[model samples]
Every structure is written in structure tokens, then in C-alpha cells.
Target: MNGESAMPPLPEIGDLAARQLVEGTLAPIVVLDADLCHLYVNPAWGKVSGLPASAFLGRTLGEVLPDLQRPDDVLRDVLRDGQPREATISGTTGVCSPLGQRLWRAVYHRVELPGQGTCLCGIGVEISSLRRYLDDLETAHQRLALLDAAATRVGTTLDIETTCQELVDLLAPSLTDLAAVAIVEEEFTGAPPPPPGFLRLRKTRGVAPPGMEWLLRQLGGPGPYVDVPRGIATRHCLDTGRPWLGNLASDELFQKVTVDPERTRLFRAAGVHSLLIAPLITPSRPVGVILLGRAGASQPFNDDDLVTIQALADRAALSIDSARRYSYEHTMALELQRALLSEPRTPHPAVEVAARYLPSGRSVLVGGDWYDSIPLPDSHTLLVMGDVMGHGFQAAVAMSQYRSLLRTIAASGAGVDKILGEFDRQVAQLGLDRLATCLLAVMDPGAGTCTAASAGHLPPARVRPDSDVEVLWLPAGPPIGTGLGGYESLTVRMDPGTTLLLYTDGLVERRDTDIDTSVQALETLSLPADGPLDDMLDTLLARLANGAYEDDVAILAARQRDAHD
Candidate 1:
């Protein structure tokens, strides 16, 4: 009856104490005995795995789970080495229960229980929500990269077809592991309110199969397929103006609505698990859609992937829109300049006039350089070439204005110097902010007379009908508003069958090189007067434009034929 006997030797509950500590105190409690029986499981484990305590208790671990017996398995090492193992379990689906599905993230630990020897325990945590959060973060990062690339590509190029192709190029490699782009018109029905649809397979990455056109044609009507109801990313994008993904294998909306089961099956056979479709949306509506596919045993793409693709599609749309605008403005600028550059009524019947404009190779900006051969009423011709400061629309506007002013002065029969004086006054009074260089030449047919003036502009080159090239570098004056002086005329005689070449400075100026060198180069490259006027001009341009000029060049070449020749 000593103190130990009075306390009944503490009941030898060391093992029970350890088990209680695991079951009640740990975050996700699990207990197992030497015989591989699960003796206890806590609420956290049941909540995570959606399994009850009864599911784990009194069961042989190996009999319940086959992965445990494999030597290379993660759990087996923890048991043999008596070490706690941490690993992410892949290829396991979430557990479904009445209350809702919960995903299990399992952690297995090996423990030694006194008298019970070695045991294996597992603690599970619910991480379904966390997994979704991480997925979202990944998707956002991808979207940002796509947008940045799209913006860079679109901002630099202005050719619509090339820009469109670039967009497809960007998408092809990322989505389908190949480059492909297609453009198609949206279909509209007049009667019976049929489902909306769009064109397909206007273009593709690589060569499309033979029946692609026919297949696309057949896609409009009812058919079993995983595409949106309207058969286009355009339709959905137009309707929603938001990014969307159609999961072929799992989406009930797709399954219920699709008509072409064979096409769906064919896609699956080709290893395309799903389609991530993004709309090429202009602000008005969706013009096209870029379709991306995960093919060849690749896991189906997730929402994040769809988002990135959507961002790229947006940039493609914007680029196309901008290119169209710029092209329209350019055409209009050319047309306006042409309207101002009307041909004068030719007095001499044998004289033929021709001109050409060559764009600079390095810049997309259109220039204000222009040429006009205005036939005077007095059996003569007024040949003019001028270049306004800057290029593009503004220069074009100035060129149009100058053309009007020159025509007005020529109609009044003023001398070249007097006409230039009037222009200087008009330019300064209008405060136009634009400066220009101009050269004007008036030739009398019967008189064999030529009088030319320069306003800081390149002088014309004379080619005798017999094909002798002579560059005329007359005394130059200050530019139109140079404040130093107005222009003066220089006189020359034009023998019968004379040819005069008036050109903008851009025709003779080369970057980082002397004007004389460029002029000499031009002289060396001029074509003989044998072909048609258009052909001769083309040859001259081909020779001059070697992909180096930074400004537009305008040329007006006049050849006055002899009375008999």
C-alpha cells in the first residue's frame, strides 16, 4: 500500500497519451498501430478527404490502397526509412460528397508507438480553394505577356494583310504548336431568323486539308460540333465582348448544343482536347476569331491560357483597325494632290507629257513633293517641281495649296520671278508654318526659249533628244520664305526635240552623302528614251529607289518632239 500502489502505477498509458496528442492537438490528426490499422482520424482529415472515421479505422493499409505496396512509391519510403514524406499527389480527382466536393492534399508521416512498434499515419488538408487561386494567378501572368507582344507587333506595322498574318503567326505557335491564321466574313440571314454564323478557313497555318473549304461551308447549318452556337469566336465575342473558352469534353452547354458529333470526335482523335477561341474584336463588333487547340496528348488548356490568347486577339484587332485608317488617309492624300496637279491644255500637238511619283523606301509617310506640266495658252509649257517641308497629310495639304497658287499666277501670265514673288508674299501672309522648295520652267515651242527659276530647289536636267544628259545646277536662291531674297530667272535655249527632267530634291539627295554623288548616280542610271513613257519612268524609279531614300520623290519629264519626228 505504498504511494505507487495507491496510484495504481499510472495505468501505463504512454501510448494512449501519444495517440491523444496526435488526434486532439495536431492540425490534421491520424494514428496507426503496428499492424497497419488506422486507430484514429481527426475532423480535419475527414473534412479534406470527404471520408468518415469508419473508412480508415480497423483496416489494413495495403489492402485499402495499392500504391502503398510499391517500393518506389513515396509512402513506402516514409514507412521503411521511418521518415516523414511530403509530396504532391497528381492524377487524383477531387472527392465528391453530398455537401460538396473537397480536394485532399495528403501528408504521410511514420511514427513509432511504444510496444506497438512502427506505424504509418496520414494527415490531409483541404486545398481545393488554394489550387484555384494559384491557377488564376498563372492565367493573369500569361495574359500580360500576350498583351505586351501583341501591342509591340501591332504598333510597328501598317500593312493590313501583313499585320493580320503577323497576328496569326503569334497565335499559331502558342496555341496549336503551329502557326495558322484565317479570316472570314460573318453570315447574316434575311428570313426565318436562323442562327447567326460566320465565314471560316479564309486562311490557316500550314496548308489546310483539301476539303477545308467544303467543311467550312457545311458548318453554317445545324451540325454536331463543339463550336459556339454561331460557329465563330466572332459571334460569341460580338455578343459578349468578353473572352470565352469552350471545353469540348466537359461543357454541358457544348454537348447539348452541338450537332456534328463526328467532327467533335475527329478533333478528339487529332489530340485536340479543347478549343480556346478569342475574338478579333473591333470596337464595333467581332470581325474574326483566333482558335487555339491543345493537341497530341497535352492536357486541356485552362482559363489562364484562354485569357492570354484573348489579350493577343485584342491587339490584332486594334492593329488591323489602325492600318485600315492609315491606308484610307494615304489614298485620300494622293487623290487630293492629284486633283490640285491638273494637266494644262497642251498647245503643241506633237508634245507628249508624262510624270511619276516614287515613294521612299524607308518611311511609310507620304510626302508633299509634286510635279506638274501646266500647258500655257501661248504654245508653251510650264513644268514645275516642288517639295513641301515634312511628309504625310500635312505636306500633302500644303502641296495642294501651292498648286492652286501656282495655277492662279500662271493663268495671269506673270513672269516666273513675279509669280514666285507673289507666292512668297502669300505664304508669309497666310502664316502657313510650312516651308517649301520649288523650281519652275516655262518653255516656248516655236521660240526655242526656256526660262527657269529656283526657290532653293534642285535644277532640272536636260536630255537632248539624241540622249545627251546635262544636269543644270543654276544659281540657287533662298527657300520660299528664306528672308534673304526672292527667286530670279535663268535663261536657256531648248533646241528642237528637247527633253527636260524636273525633280524634287529627294530624287538627288542621299543620306550622309554629297548631293553631287547622288546626282551623278542618277545620271548614270537614267534610261535611254526608247520605251513607253510609263516603262521609262518605271525603269528610272527602279534604278533610283535602292531601298535607301527617306523622303518621297516627284518627277516631271517633258519631251517636245520635232515637227516631223
Candidate 2:
């Protein structure tokens, strides 16, 4: 501020050249003395930091940048140690022009003036763009992880409630801020209408003041009513399957629909300026919107933020679509599979029955494997386990038809062999050769006898209550629908405490592994020969599926109830 030109403008080299290079590059430039005072700042500094050159001149770093509020210790360390400090410092020290105040990663460089009496020089670079990209990558990776986990978790659960609960749990950590997933029941015609149960925030994150629910209800308007003002983001998301962004004050669309003055007050109180919403569009129609609110002095959502959040929402939409489809198909398959499974045949006068079925892993197919235990009018019981070829809706359909046919045949007073023959003939007649295979058995509780017939299905294993495993080797006839000639059935006497294990090939046939080997492996597991049929079957499945089952299975276990015990 004093002697002009006495501080000779040296050759455009050394410190001068460096300053010229920084100034010409369009980045803010600052020269710091050893005491951290602002010796010189380029014109670009005023544009970026929003501080006029006259006000910034000759001022101490702390005095000129009071908004930064950087701790005195940090400055002392930088000055005393003569080391350049570079970090993404937040808070007031991070303040910039009104436009650049959102988020920024700053890079600081320090170089010592060797012969210039221990003075130091420093510079800063803005890296907010780079940080944004990295954030986007991380968000995408997390969304994919959620999708994979949902698929696995949903596959194992039989009930929709459990599946949805598991899905919410999986999404919690990533979308921790998600308010809730309300099941919206809406009928969409040509007109766009609010979903029934309009805006029920089922789950809330973060803090909640008293009457938060009431507030959200007031904001959303009374349910079953018409004329709700849609936010800019909401309208855009609905009209086009894309996201919408409007800066806080400039979003005129939002003002048009805000009916509640209290809601507006609350938004302003929370400093919420901008809104971004993504609709959960399924293949059928738009379901709901995932809304995000950003409140501050910062500008509204930008192109990059819109694209990034929309990308995340798109993945969520796909996942939601997949989950809905999987759930619907799974429910249908389960109901059909349940129907194919005949009610349990009482093992004795005082018998109890319980059973469990598991389908294949998370694939597009719902397998054709099934089981049944039907009470016969003749006082005997019919136990059957069968696996039709292939896996999927078609396979399941074929299995259902065959199961119905088998039931009818068994009910007609025919022997197991006669029923199996009829089943094969029917399948062949229907041209379902590639879609059928089955085993049928008639158990006489009074005689303690089992007459079994198979069309290339797994043999029933008879386990002796006294630790001896009777591996039955009844020869299997050609699989049903193969047009094989009629076959004879095998009849064997069952001891009072004997256990009969009926299972689909999926239980013993693993990819790249021999069926006999897997069967043997199952036999080796220590399963009690005389127990509750359900318990025995459970142990069998647990032992067989040592890790994971690549195919679906149906298991039926029949054991004489111990009269004395």
C-alpha cells in the first residue's frame, strides 16, 4: 500500500512468473507471508472468494477470511512449522461466493522461499467436480448391492410380509434416510390421481418433533380428497419418466400448488430450498415417488445431481419391479405347489402331520418338484413324491395337471402300479413327454405294507429305527410320458417303526455330482429312524443341503406312530 514500483516488478520469472502463471490460469491465487498474511491476491480471488481486492489487501489470513473460522492452532502450526496445509476444511473457513458455498474439496500447495528470509507461498485448487463423480460411483455400487441382497432374501421367505420386512432391513443402511415404504393402493385410469392412502409416511428417519405425523398429513392434504398441489419434481417425474429439479426460490412450479401456508412455513424454517423426487415406475404404471429435500443457502439441484439421483432411482425402480414380479409369481407357484401337495395321510389313529417345501434358488423358474400324502378311503394312506422335467411356469403347470390325474387315479381303487401306468399313458397322450416323471405309493397302515411304483423317479428310502439304513433299490420304470410299456409295482412289508423317505431327484441330483453319491451322502447323515415325520424330514433336508440347493425339492416322510411310546 506504500511505495509503488519500489518493490520492483522483477523479470516475469521466479515468484512473479509463478504468480502470473496462477493468475492467467483462471484460478484464485494468493501470496502468503511467513506470518500467513495476504501479501497479494489476483483478481480471480475476488471473483471466487467474493472479497474485493481493497478489503483483502495486507490483511492477516484470519482477519481477511473471518468466515472461515479456522482454528488458531491450525494456523499457528502452518506458520510455525512453515509447512503448507492442504485439506478439505469445512465450516465457515470453507465459505466462498454465494454460488460456490455448497461442497468443495480444496487442494493447498506450499513452497518455501529459499533466500527470501524464510517466507512461504501457498495456493488452492477447487476439486468439487471430482468429489461429485466419486460420490456417484459409490451410490451406484450400494444400489446394486441392495438389489442382489433383496433377491437372495426374498427367495428364502414364503410370506410377503417377511420378504418386505427383509427388503426394508437390507435397504436401511444405504437408504437410511428413507421415511417409509407405504403400500399404496391406486387405480390409474387416463387421469393422474393421487394414490389411495395418500402419503402415509410409514417410517421416519432422523429426529421428529411432536405431531410430525400430523404435519405430514396436513402437508399431503386429507386422503380421499382431490386437488393436491404437486411439487415441481413430482409433476416432472409424473409427466415424463424422468426427474425434475428447480432451485429453491426460482422453482415457480412449487409455488403454484402449495395450498398449506403452515407447510411452507415449516419448509422455510428447516431451510429446505430445493426438492428432487423420483417416481417408482413399475412396468404396469407409476407407483410412488422417493422424495429428497435439500435445504440451505445452496442452489437447487443441478443437471449432474438430477442425473445421479435419477440413476439411483432407476435402479430402485428395476429392483422394485423385479421384486413385485418375483413376489407375484412366487405366490402363484406356492399356491399351485400347495394344491399339488395332497393333505397329510394320518400315520396312525393318533397321528400328527407337518411338512415344509422349498423352491429352487433365486432364478426365473419355479420348479416342478412336489409331494403328497393323501388319506385313502380304504383306511390305507397314499404317499407320493414326484418331479416333472424342467423348471418354470410351464413345468409347474404340467406338474399340477399330472398331480390332479394321479389323485384321481388313486381315488379310483386302483393299485399303485395301475395308477402309475395310467399316469404315464395320460402324459404320453398329452404329449408331455419332456415334462413328466413321477412316483406313487400305497401304504396300508393295518398291514404295515408299502406298494410303490415309479416312472423313473427316486426310490423311496426305508430307514430301520435301529440304526440300519435299508437302501431300497427298486428298479424304476421309464419316466412318465416316455411311451415305455406298462410296468409292475414293487410291494414291501414295512415294520411298525420303519421310516419311509420320499423325495424328488432335486434332493439327490446336484450338478456335476452323481445321484448315487449324493444319496449316499444323505444316508451318512445321522438322522433318527423313529421320530416325528416332520422332524425326520427336516433333518434330511438340512443334511442334504450342506451349503445350498441349486434346485427345488419336495419331500414326504411317513413313519408308523409308536403306540407304546
Candidate 3:
């Protein structure tokens, strides 16, 4: 057909000639009369649709294959406008041999018959296999992206709960409608599981649909531990160390895992149709179980999904195991440090004292900050504050050793400088590798005097009744274990109502600020004029290192007593 006038129709051929052309072509072809009724379908059309041409001929396109109505409408438009059109339409067609589905790209043209007014002709190619391949490729790419993201999104910290939360957040609203992680209580405390009465499961993290969170909470809230019952899916997974895939459609199987009738009812009310519980297994043992569910119209868990979830569970198990080990070591070190840093000796009634030792926050390992008070022979008192260079068990051990040696040397009648010098020599002689900072103060109430020395430590603060707080300016010395023994002492009058404060750098050190600035801030603190020594120390600590301080802190404050009191 020519473009001009939009009505120059084709030179119609005889039925034999049309049949010969259509039968020879591999692509399916169909012809329709002006009324849009199928007049002919060739052998190729019969092969593609799996229907004999007799079944299609003389029938309206919609009546023969309703799924093709939209494409047929496009052909009608081409016939009405006297134009040629090419288009692709995709959907299930019952006319196929297996009666499943097929995607097709077709070209339609308007033509005139010798006797009839006009007709529509179509040639289509099946693209079902190619479309399926493309869809599968896209799905594979998405799965790869998810696995790649899990590497960074999960296990970002050495905290078990935080890691579990990360895993749930990554999976929910993406992989499944509901996701949760349940770790054994024994994993946290490093203790054996109690009897069934105390067999607890800690739901560390979870996510669910809006308004469905209550159902998850009913199962078990995220923070607190809950008792594991006889036949719960979590219990089975943990005991067997194998994944449990459940089709919630089966009432028996669903009831077997739900432990309670109420929970079963809730599960059905929430429209949960499928579930998967994967054990978080490590090389040593199973640490926990990851529970995933699909609700409403969400797709059921398949073999591919099972493989992916197991991979995620493996990664989470490793991180949780590492955190558990670290927690055990941290607890041991903290206990040892606390034991070594027992309440300082109350040397004499003439000198009232108050001290505090706080371990670092969870993000930091326990360190070697310690304080002590040793009574000398003649009512004199020796006070010490020290911090080892590193953190964790090694530093704690070093701190305990240093504290014992210092007390031993001070009790032998050595002066403050000699005590520090000897401590340094002994630290080197013992081949102890870690360095430590220390400050020592010798107070004699009868003499009304105090002498202090330092080993690469911050200067102590002195508060007098009539004067502003002052930072004692002692000569800075190298840290112990250096064997560079030039320790010096500074003597200052110790009048009644005067308070001496000795503390570790943690009390006035922040990574974001300079050490001098933090020290100056501490030195400028205001103390209550008539407050008790403990009250005054508490106030100073509140001002300097609030509870959120990053590192461990140790402070010792001593106030000289009035002769009348």
C-alpha cells in the first residue's frame, strides 16, 4: 500500500498464492477481514499457538484468544487508519500446546482484498525463551548485589546485639517480610545451659510488618531472654544444628513449631504462609538461629533462598563467636583490675581520703588505671596513681605488678624521688616491656608538709580554702620501664582544709581536644567550700569526666584534717 490518500490498498492475491507464502514463512501469520474476524491462520500460526487453523478461522480474535485482545486492538487501529504498525505484547495464552504462556513480537499491516473492502494481516515471532532468560539474568544480578552488600552491612562491630540488628535490617522489607535472630543465653554468659525451666533464648534483633510487630513481641521481645519450650522451631534448629523450612499451609507442621495455641492463631491472623529457620553454625558449635518468614502475598522460600540465607547465617555466626570470646576476656580482665584496685588503705585518721576507679565504656577494652594508699611507719601516708601504656589483660597484669612493687619500696622508708627511681630500675630489671605513668605523694600531717614525684604523669591538682584551684607543677619524668631514672620531687605545705587530688590522664584526656586544654579545664573546676572530701571528689569528677568518658579513670583525693576537729 502507498502512503498517499491513506487508502491505496494492496493488490490482493488468490487464496492459493497467500497460502503458499504464509506456509513457507517460519513466523506465524494470520489474516482478518474488515469485521476483525479471523479469516485465515497458516501452518506456522497453528504450530505457535498449538491449535489447528480450522479452530481459529471464522472466529473473532477476542473469542479465539482473549489474551491477545490488546494486540488485536492495535491491528484494528492499523486497519482503520490504513497504516502499518509493529508492536510487542506479552502474557499467558491458553492456546499454546501446553496451555501455559508465551511472549510475542508482532507486525501488522492493512491491505485490501480483491472483492472485500479491507483486511488486517499479522506476522509474529515467539520470544518466550529469550524473555525467560533475560528475567533469570536480572534476578541473578540482584542476588549477587545483596550478597555483596551483606559484607559491609553485617558484622560491622564486635557487638553481638548490634551485629544481629544489622543483619535483620538488611534482610527485612527486601528478602522477607519478617526476620529475627535468636542467640542462646549460654553464648553470652559463657555458661552451660540451665534446665528447661531456665533454658533461655535471647532474641537479639527482629523486624516485621507494620502492626505485626506486636506478634513478633508476643513470640519474644528483642532485648530480654525467653524460655525455650519443648517443640518450638528455634529449639529444634538449635538442637539439630540444621535449617527448618516450613510451609505454614500445613496445619500440623505449623502447629508443631508454634508451641502455643495463641501464637498459632496469631501466625494465621498475620497471614504468615512460609518460614525458614537457619542455624547460625560455626566451626566449633551452633551459636544461634536466624528466623525468616513470608506473609500475605510474599513469595515462599525456595532452594535458592535457603542457600543465600545459610550464607548469611554463616557470616553472622563467625562474628557472634568472636564477640563472645572478646566479652569473656574483657570480663576476666575487668575483674582482675577491680580486685587489684581495692579500696585504698585508710592510712591515718589525720588524712581523710576518697577514691574512685571507673572502667572504660564498652567500646574500649579494660585498661591498667589504678590507685593506692600505703601507710608508712610514722603516721605518714604514701599515695599513688598509675596507668600502664596499653589495655586489656596484659596492661592489667602490669598495673598489678607495678602497684605491689611501689608499695613495697615506699614501706622501706625511701623518699618519694628514691621510690620512683627504684621502681623504674626494677621495672627495667624485670624485663617488663610495657611502659607506665605514675604520680606519688608523701603526706606527713605532723610536719604539715607534702612531697610529690612524677613518672611521665599529669601534674596533680591542689585546692586550698582561700585560693583558686591550682595544678601542681612537678618536673615531668620519663615513664617507668625506660630505666632513664631522673625522677624529681616537689614539696608543698599541707595546711589544714587543703585538698590534694591525684588522677590518671583518662580524667582529662579526649582525642578531639589537646591534653593541656583538658587539664586546664580540670584545674579550673570549683569545689564546695565546706563539702566533705568524698562529696568534693565526686563533684570534681562529675565536672571533668562525665559518665560517658571514653577511657578508664582513677582518682584519689586526700584532705588534711583540722587539729580541732
lDDT of each candidate versus the true structure: 0.62, 0.60, 0.79
Instruction: Please report the TM-score between candidate 3 and the true structure.
Output: 0.78
Q: What TM-score does prediction 1 earn?
A: 0.60
- What's the TM for model 2? 0.62
| Deviation in Å, model 3, residue 289 alpha carbon | 0.9
What is the RMSD of candidate 1?
8.9
- Cα lDDT tens digits, model 2, 1-565, are 1111111233333476664575565565565555666656666555555656666656775686665534345545666765666544333333343333333343334455534344434445555556556776886676666656555653244433444355445443344222223223333345466554233222211222233434344445554233333443444465467765545654354554344544666555555566555565666666445555554544566675565555555545555555556667776777776665545555445233455678876564676877777777656777878787888777877777777777787777788777888778777788774656677777786777888887787787877877466666676788888766476788899888787778777677888888887776655666776567777777777767745567787777777666675
lDDT of 3 by residue, 1-565 (tens): 0111111233553455754575677887777887777777767766665666666766876676676635666777897798799877666554543324577788988887766668887888988788878877887788788888888988877778888899899888778899988787775465456565545777788899897888788876344776777677778887787889996557667766665655677778888889898998898887888888899989798788888788878888898878767777767766777787778888788888889877777543667888988888788889899999988878888888888888888878789899999999999999999999999999999999999999999999888886368888899889999999999999999777888899998788888899988888765678864678778877877777655677888899987777787
Higher-TM-score candidate of 1 and 3? 3
* Candidate 3 lDDT score relative to the true structure: 0.79
Winning candidate number (lDDT): 3
Q: Which residue runs does candidate 2 get wrong by more than 4 Å?
A: 1-275, 282-284, 294-303, 340-356, 362-370, 374-378, 391-401, 408-415, 418-435, 464-470, 486-493, 528-531, 546-549
Residue 261, candidate 2: alpha-carbon lDDT? 44
Cα deviation at 312, candidate 1, in Å, is 2.4
